[model samples]
Target: MSTYSYRIVNVFTQGDDPFSGNPLCVFESAESLDTPRMQALARQFNLSETTFMLPSTRANARVRIFTPSYEMPFAGHPTLGTAHVCRALGLAGDTLTLEMQAGLIPVYATQRRWTLQASANGPSG
Candidate 1:
């Protein structure tokens, strides 16, 4: 197996719950991605959350969100925080698509912060 190359970046994103502190992540990426390595990366960060960026064989970038415990399909803070890091690291565009386990998540961004909207491709109520 090959190594998953990732960049550890610190970020902050406010969640609905006031008590929920800003999430952080050590964004991981490489030629391939898997669960065990993803879990290990999350553990290493030991933050409110972590993420792995894996571009899908189909289209758009596949993003995996993880807490210290288990992986999450769609998360507000993780989505925003990862976008922030991706943009900061010059890996994002004005508008980008995030392919999470849930589905295709469209992300819009500005110079300062990122805004996420949930749709059939993503989270919906």
Candidate 2:
């Protein structure tokens, strides 16, 4: 028997309203979980998106994004929200570069808000 840690956060939320933002589930230190397990966990959470934090040799962290139904190479809200969680967990610094299947996504954080860069390819991430 084993257990993993996770956190729930609100992404792109309006001030002071818990229901205003897109809810995200971030699985911390998820290097042990495989794709199928991650997908199942995402389905169990049933949020718009869920993210898994993995150790990265090239970037600050490697992020895997999943919906209830499938995996995603990259996503916007999940990226930002996951970055916030990474910083909070000491897994990354204030500015983070996340390695994803699509590409490297950079995120900058302030005390209150976090922002992600739009890749030259487009805004899909």
Candidate 3:
């Protein structure tokens, strides 16, 4: 038998209404899941994106973002959403730095909203 837990949140919403924003599924402490399982979970959720939280030696947490079809190194919505989840779960403070494949990204939050400092990836061919 096996068990995994997740939380559903709507990011970038207009207000307190849950349905106003993009829905995301976040898995906490997903260190045990391998790539295939993570992909499967993301597909199962069928949301715009899904995030898996993992342990990080360099940042507050390492996050893996995935869509139903593929994985993304860094994404705006997931980054902000994950940071919000981290704060809510007490894994982070008002500010959070997430380690993604692109690099370490910082996020700051207030009572009303969250902000992320994302570096430009440059033009993609």
Candidate 4:
């Protein structure tokens, strides 16, 4: 068996409530994981959404979002949550871009708070 590092975070929280907002699980590195493994990991986490981090040629990093049942091209909370993890890992600065299935997303962070710029046309697939 192989070991992987992951972080769980709450997005869109108000004040200091740790339990508030949506819960998300982000895998620090998914260089070795395939689609099946990623799907299984998402199922194992059993959260609304789980994300994996990968190397990117178009942006600071690449992100893949998955639910227990399916993969999503893009998602708001997941994008922000993943961006937060990216910043924590020093993969990118306060302002960075995440390449997603939908398209490229630009994220900005201030401390623990994170935000993403959505595509005007929205996700494609």
State every prediction's TM-score relative to the real structure. 0.73, 0.91, 0.92, 0.94
Q: Candidate 2 or 4, higher TM-score?
A: 4
Candidate No. with top TM-score = 4
Q: Write the per-residue lDDT of candidate 3 for residues 26-96, one digit (tens) a residue.
A: 99889899999999999998998999999999889999999999999888899888998899889889987
Candidate order by decreasing lDDT: 4, 2, 3, 1
Candidate No. with top lDDT: 4
lDDT of each: 0.69, 0.89, 0.88, 0.92
Per TM-score, what order, best first?
A: 4, 3, 2, 1
Give the total clashing residue pairs for model 4. Answer: 0
Cα deviation of 119, candidate 2, in Å = 2.0
lDDT (10s digit) by residue, model 1, range 24-110: 664546435568877877887787678887767542467888888898888877777677666666676767777777876777887
> Tens digits of per-residue lDDT for model 2 on 8-79?
999988988977899999998898999999999999999999999998887899899999999998889999
Between prediction 2 and prediction 4, the one with superior lDDT is 4
Which residue pairs in candidate 4 collide? none
The lDDT, on a scale of 0 to 1, for candidate 4 is: 0.92
**Candidate 4 regions off by >4 Å?**
123-125
Which 10-residue window of candidate 3 scores lowest in summed lDDT?
116-125
| Model 4 alpha-carbon miss at residue 109, Å | 1.4
